[model samples]
Target: MLFKFRRHWETPWEVVDSKAVKPVYMYYDDEDSLDIVAVSDADTRGTYVFEVNHLTRTALRNAVTFSRQQLIHQVAKKGFNVLVLESWRLTIFRRGKSHRVEVMYSGRPAEALGKLPHLPPPPFMDVLHEFM
Candidate 1:
């Protein structure tokens, strides 16, 4: 099989919990994947890490086909009792007895809408120290 890949930006993101909220910065390696760097104003539940196998064609498409409304229901069908997903390619794995529910997302609004509005920065801010 043949494959093609492109790199996204190394940008800061926001993570909002029920009572507390903070910012998280994500960086990309030349390896075609991103890594979590820091969370502002609050500590992470732990150093949560995710290495997306963008090559997983089937899995990636299956994840994206759900309607905006069905996204939550599809995730619940897996196992998570309570779930939260970010706007971008960040997913949260919630605990379950035999397994956990995984929410997979990627912020490709431009790809989805063909054109998007010029949105402002997140409420919180952080910097991306370029990997040297």
Candidate 2:
């Protein structure tokens, strides 16, 4: 899916390929900013931090239809710790202090992560069951 970024002091929007890297932490601030820290290179533990303005923030907010804390709570209710969105799949991870396990939901490449717009609908029990 396409992710748009409006950087601070920049009027034009910057488009990015969300699937290029796996995002580990994502937050939307009250100042109309969206902060995302992704694992750019797992081998080096490198990260890419993107701080974008209101437009991008609104796009993401509309996509998820929920607040950051709500999303985390929803995922926690299912016993998952991390959520990764790829071009072709949604991968949910269960992490421990040292190790992590994952479960993937395939198809729906166009759908944004956290926004499960498929049949048999929301509260994604099928996907959540994988975590258990």
Reference-based lDDT, each prediction: 0.27, 0.28
lDDT of 2 by residue, 16-96 (tens): 222212332222234232233332222111121223233233333222222223443444444443333221122222222
Superposed Cα deviation of residue 6, candidate 2 (Å): 38
Residue 115, model 2: lDDT of 33
TM-score of model 1 (CA atoms): 0.18
Best by lDDT: 2
lDDT of 2 at 28: 26
Badly placed stretches (over 4 Å) of model 2 are 1-66, 86-132
> RMSD in angstroms, candidate 2?
20.1
Q: In candidate 1, list every pair of residues with a backbone clash.
A: 88-107
Off by over 4 Å in 1: 1-55, 67-69, 72-86, 90-101, 104-132
